[model samples]
Target: MKLPINESGLAASQLIYGCMGLGGGWNRDPIQSEHITQAHEVVELALENGINMFDHADIYAFGKAETVFGQVLKEKPTLRENMILQSKLGIRFPDEEKGLPARYDFSKSYILDSVDGILSRLNIDYLDVLLLHRPDVLMDSREVAEAFHQLKSSGKVRYFGVSNMSAGQIRLLQNNCNEKLIVNQLEMSLDKIGWLETGVHVNQVAARDNVLPEGTLEYCQLENIQLQAWGSLAKGIYTGRDLENAGENVKNTALLVQRFAEEKQVSQEAIVLAWLMKHPAAIQPVIGTTNLARIQGCVEALKVTLSRDEWYTLYVSSRGVSLP
Candidate 1:
């Protein structure tokens, strides 16, 4: 339940409850007023299960995610010190009146202003972590570094991280920013690891190639930055579908795995989570499930150690082929 720490020395739960799903549950539908109480109650459930970290983005549900998270904090303000609350900035929501300014904003002025906005929304004086939601190709390292310095010195944000950034992009800012960015929350999952390879996912075949380099994975390991895995359930891609091994075989395999999950006293989601945790790298999987039962199952992944061969088997299943 304790956090998986990184080089910059920040730590929080290995299983961070993604707040996007909180604004709207798995159905991507808003929680009704009747459900709001229990919805907020889920925060306590997550915390009791050792999930002290919560991940949210500024644009999630057009900012309702942070608002709801703020409500949870207000209801349990005393729990603030016990948890590591985090959110991201950057993605400007579209507004016709605002000249349709839908784009990534990493400018110094934007970054500073975003902090104040998030502070007011979350009702927290300071954040445990603040991430640049995604890389801005036009990002100026000097501008970002200056904003980071100001935020850290003013105690507006205690820790810094980046999301959806490549190894090189992170280095660009990391080198410039005097305050160390503690982590990089990449959109990584075993299935989404096309970033780890150099195919169409990385483009020997596309015009604008995937920015992730072949050495990206190796670089993170060498640098000691904890990779937070998003979309860990393959975005529920295999829910009722076949395992990569056999199309017709999924019904039974899925049922069997689901049964094992129950017998092992974990949800099916946890099985996927455990698969990620099996990796040696200090990676954390962000779980977006709103069901407390499923949330608890994900937390269980930290202890479920898959054997080396089993790990590859799952990898092969995910790839729909054996490794070369």
Candidate 2:
């Protein structure tokens, strides 16, 4: 199944390689030569594994992630043509010296300036897509619209999207922006089942417990907004993480995942990811693993397709609740 992003004329990959794990660790330290070497390995591995869409954020590793990535671009300028590069903005960390608390910023100047920083750090002329990292409660749609207009007109960004936004939030912003919002990324995984529970528990007493932004699933689907799943691996809980302190449900789910992996003759990562992909939303899993072996395991997901019964069994096991 093709991603909804393809409709926008950008040939994005089925899976996205999240850059959160790059640039060594999230610190204020300078990017070392080793970091650049690691970035090269990750970029090459991802391309070999069929992931050409790279995801990044301005705050990842205090901007060193983009810096190391920029080194990769410096080495291989030709990679610009084959890759679809995406990055996010709007999340500002605390600055005690400036007496500013951590906050989300969508102001026009912040938006425009953030894009420039992103481009300069990544050594790119423009972004394939730029997402508002998270909703800024005080955001002004007109200011955002104006910033997007400038970016689009100047070719700074080709597409716009959001992360961790609700349906109403997206609608409110979309109502004012001239550009189409083509992506909505949220935390979705076997461990994070709120998105699925919102639909399944409808009209039931358990519905009240679901905190997923209402109508988000259906809204994104109807609007042709590609839904991207971050934390899609659930921190490896269902794959090979130590379950000694895990709850009964998670342990059981891990065992079940192992069973499926054994029966299907694929890696555990394949089973865990295939379950999320089984959703009709065509959700693209953003894998953040930097381990070369684990990266190979994640790519195995593209080969497996779960039957309906298999999907439900895994879902129910992970939720630790019977369907009402």
Candidate 3:
């Protein structure tokens, strides 16, 4: 399925290969040959399986994720043309030496500089989409608009979007920027059911406790903004994560996932992802597994189709409660 990334005839894959696990561990570790080999294997495998959209962030692996990915592009530049390369910026990790706390930045200069850094590390000229990693509480919409204008005018980025933002926050940024925000990525998965709960819990006590901003899902659907789901795999919770210390609801959900996988003859990863994709919003799930077998398992989701009963069964099991 082609995702409506923009009106410029650019479309992304139904699944996005998240590169957070690339370039070794998150530290000042050097990019070793093993890391490079693993990257090549992952990229080659993902491309072979029809995943043409890759997601990245500057903060992933202390910037080494993009760095190693750059090696893949450098070795086989043609691969760059076949895929939709996307990366995000704006999150600044804490630096004790600089006397700085971890914070988000959306200042004009920071945006421009971050884009340059992202492009440089990825060894790319322009990004298919550039997302502000998270909303900066101190963001000035006008200032961000101006920065976007410069990036667009100079051909540094083709499109713009935001991540981890609420509907109200998106509206505020949309009001100031000329660019139409095309994507709003958030944590959505069977494990993170707040997005679904917000809709189902209306006029009920559960509504007050839902973490997803009300109307966020509907607003994205109404605006034609592509909703991408990060943490969509829920860190392998239901699929195969150890449930020894998990709650009753989680253990039950995991068992149900296995049952479905067995009945459908697909990987548990596929069932987990298919459940998320069943939503009408057409959410693009970002899968970050570095394991080759797990990556192959994730792509199996495209083959399985869960009916309404199956979908709700997983949902109710995960929530451990009847719908209000």
The collision pairs in model 2 are none
**Please, what are the lDDT tens digits per residue for candidate 1 over residues 1-324?**
565566545557778888886555434465465445655777889888888888878777766677777877787789888878889998886579868867888999999998898888788999888999977879999889999999999999988888877778888888998877677777766566565444334334542455566656666677776778888766664444445764533344355446546767766677677777776776788888776666776777776766686666555665554445
lDDT of each: 0.73, 0.92, 0.92
Count of steric clashes across candidates, in order: 1, 0, 0
Query: Tens digit of lDDT per residue, candidate 2, span 86-141?
Result: 99999999999999999999999999999999999999999999999999999999
C-alpha RMSD by candidate, in order? 3.8, 1.1, 1.0
Residue pairs with colliding backbones in model 1 are: 3-12
Residue 166 CA displacement from its true place in model 2, Å? 0.7
lDDT of 1 at 55: 84
Clash list (residue pairs), candidate 3: none
Q: Which regions of candidate 2 deviate over 4 angstroms? A: 1-6
Looking at candidate 2, the ten consecutive residues that score lowest on lDDT are 1-10
Tens digits of per-residue lDDT, candidate 3, 190-304, equal 9999999998988888799988888999999898888999999989888878889998889999999999999999999999999999999999999999999999999999999
Native-referenced Cα lDDT, model 1: 0.73
**lDDT value, residue 275 of candidate 2:** 95
